[model samples]
Target: MRLEQADPKRLVAESYRIEGITDGECRSIFIDWALSLPVGVDARQAIKRLLAEYRGTAPDHPMTAVLRAGLHKAPQARRRGGARGRRI
Candidate 1:
């Protein structure tokens, strides 16, 4: 089903549910989902993009928070140094 046919928020919520994510974490995941898309891809494609990258993995609230703040910061915790990476 397409994102327009399916609720974008609900899709995101379901993704969170599958990953056992919290509500606060949803916003970040949703944002990351949005950013991952090509410039003009539709919402369905956007959701698909997010799912491809994030689905199946458990949500990390702290990581979500950083990603929500800015995609560039999401990997900071995983970096060998404190340098920020490229933005999503």
Candidate 2:
């Protein structure tokens, strides 16, 4: 669920809540969570907030790595010229 001003994906939050959850499962949920975000949302900031919230609780959880990866990931630029439009 979206916290105050963070707007983190609910799936990600729920994944963290799952007991004995696997890294693969969390990774899958993370993919969905990332995809569900609105365009232009600051994913790194959201992930940082999430990590802060869960820090002392699940330090060893696989979600921590996933969140960290999300945080460190560079913003991807949209790739154009796939043959959709615009002749050079």
Candidate 3:
């Protein structure tokens, strides 16, 4: 009963089809793909599915690399040398 595809626009899928696609291009496409997901859809799960879909077919594709990178959550950066945290 799913209403939409995990990749509604197939941006990720198309990225793999592109010739000589770069990581930067893949990144841009990934961003658009992520934003295009229907509200309430789980992005993590979508990413996993996308990875599985392309992994075997295009293991070295830039889009596949981008999707794999997307699976990881970046660490929060803390401010350094901030005066606000200092007190007299």
Give per-residue CA lDDT, model 3, range 10-83, as digits (tens): 78777888899999999999999988998888988888888777799899888888888898999899766778
**Highest lDDT against the true fold, candidate:** 3
TM-score of each: 0.31, 0.69, 0.85
* lDDT by residue (tens digit), candidate 1, 1-88: 4544323444454555554556666665666656554455665544444444443463364433433343332444553444355433
The lDDT of each candidate is: 0.48, 0.76, 0.83
RMSD of each: 11.5, 5.0, 2.7
lDDT of 2 by residue, 1-88 (tens): 2464354447766877899999899898888877877777677777777788886788888988888887664888875776774556
TM-score result, candidate 1: 0.31
Candidate 1 residues lying further than 4 Å off, grouped into runs, are: 1-14, 17-19, 44-88
Worst 10 residues of 3 by lDDT: 1-10
Supply the TM-score for candidate 2: 0.69
Q: What's the C-alpha lDDT at position 76 in model 2? A: 89
Once fitted onto the true fold, the runs of candidate 3 whose alpha carbons sit more than 4 angstroms away are: 1-4, 77-79, 84-88
After superposition, the stretches of candidate 2 with alpha carbons farther than 4 Å from their true spots are 1-9, 74-88
